[model samples]
Target: MFSYNVNEEIQLRLLELRHTDELFALTDGNREQLRQWLPWVDGTVDTEHTKRFIQSTLAAFAGNNGIQAGIFYKGNMAGCVGLHGIDWGNRKTSIGYWLGAEYQGHGIMTNACGTLVNYVFSELNLNRVEIRAAEFNTRSRAIPERLGFVQEGKIRQAEWLADRYVDHIVYGMLREDWSMNGQASNRFEVETDE
Candidate 1:
């Protein structure tokens, strides 16, 4: 239900099944690119399946468990990011994202993550956010690092990806850290420059 601009070229909009066709098309177009880091997508996405998934996510959002967004760049579907498996009383949530291969290396994801994290802390009133990435996923890990998230350590054999169990690096950021030092608007200090 929320909408925000990640940058001049990109818009991040909260998602629902009403755009199932759009979701399916984007996911289908980048199946192989996604499979390298995300094994959860089995390359079988279609409009019907996307609708069901979006419905499930919408239900989660209603129950205060999650929010999922479809990333749009210049009016075209570009990728996705989600704050899921929420624990409101604990004031914590996990962040996850995937960009089509075409969208990688453009800093789009870093900007999107920063904006979403800001929204979660300010608008959703969350205290802490966690981001986990497979050990080999440099692109994924960079999002949290560039946002000033603290590296908490790694969980050995934490996630199953590419048909094998892999270690996962966990990163966390508290609301205080973000508000005090991580805001993107402060021209004197950049989050990544630290």
Candidate 2:
């Protein structure tokens, strides 16, 4: 049970079976908007599907591969942020995240992402962390950019979002770069129960 208080208003907690209902409702309510960016939105047609997703995230945490955490804003589920997986041999991992449309413009995703980036460099002792966003998704790309990640490269036709192929812009932050940037110091009071 990992939990981190990003601020007085935002908290990140490891996803659990109990979160299925709220998670499903959040996704369902935001289906049309989320469908534009996330490919799995259509596949998540029921709470059972959301349950399986949570189950997999738990398994990933148990296996020490990575984690998927739900973002809580003002005590309500707002969205999710997570690592895709970790390549331990290479000391690197990539992050993915999304926020319900109603939660946008509040900087919730950016702060949540910063916390994960800090965890990756300090707690996980990983050398590099990457965040990839669809080339046209300025909101998504802004998170990494706001946190000082470098624009590493781009992969054409990297993802199939709905009916079309979308290019991906890769952003990367290395442990050394993070440390040198001074933002490495946790800006928010962090609490973790594992």
Candidate 3:
């Protein structure tokens, strides 16, 4: 398991099967709001669905393909953030994340993402990290922008929401950019369970 102490108020932990119930409830409660930007909302029917998702992420972790972590706010499961998958040969990865509705505006996701970006560049030694969000979802898109990602372009009708298709705005960050930004104040520690 991988964990990060982003700060005193925000922490991240590997999403495990045991967290299914709470994660499910969090998502379910924020379903309408989340469904607008997330494609998998409709498929997440219950705790069982959450468990399967966690299991797949565990497999991905074991295979060194990806990592999915839960965002814990003040010791409670508040959201999730992760690398959807990494292209080892290219040293690139795409990040995906979502926070509970009530947890928004708390700066949790931003700190969590900053920590993950730090991990990607400093620990994983990856070259590029990408974040894609619906064009209309300003809040989601703002994360990558605030993290100093460059806006690459937009893909028209790139993703389908429940009612319609939405354009996707792509943002990318390079290892070079991170190094010159001065990281002395925002480094995070990664702890793994044996």
Q: Compute each candidate's TM-score over C-alphas.
A: 0.91, 0.95, 0.94
Q: Is candidate 2 or candidate 3 better by TM-score?
A: 2
lDDT of 1 by residue, 95-188 (tens): 9998887777677788788888888888889899999998988878888887789999999998777788989999999998888894735222
Instruction: Give candidate 3 regions above 4 Å deviation.
Output: 183-194
TM-score attained by model 1 = 0.91
The list of candidate 2 runs beyond 4 A from truth reads 187-194
Error of 2 at 138 (Å): 0.9
Top-down lDDT ranking: 2, 3, 1
When 1 and 2 are scored with lDDT, the better candidate is 2
Against the hidden true structure, what lDDT does model 3 obtain? 0.87
After superposition of all CA atoms, the RMSD between model 2 and the true structure is 4.2
Error of 3 at 27 (Å): 0.8
Q: Please report, in order, the local distance difference test score of every candidate based on alpha carbons.
A: 0.81, 0.90, 0.87
Tally clashes: model 2.
0
List of clashing residue pairs for candidate 3: none
Better-scoring candidate (TM-score), 1 or 2: 2
Q: Let me know the TM-score candidate 3 reaches against the reference structure.
A: 0.94
TM-score result, candidate 2: 0.95
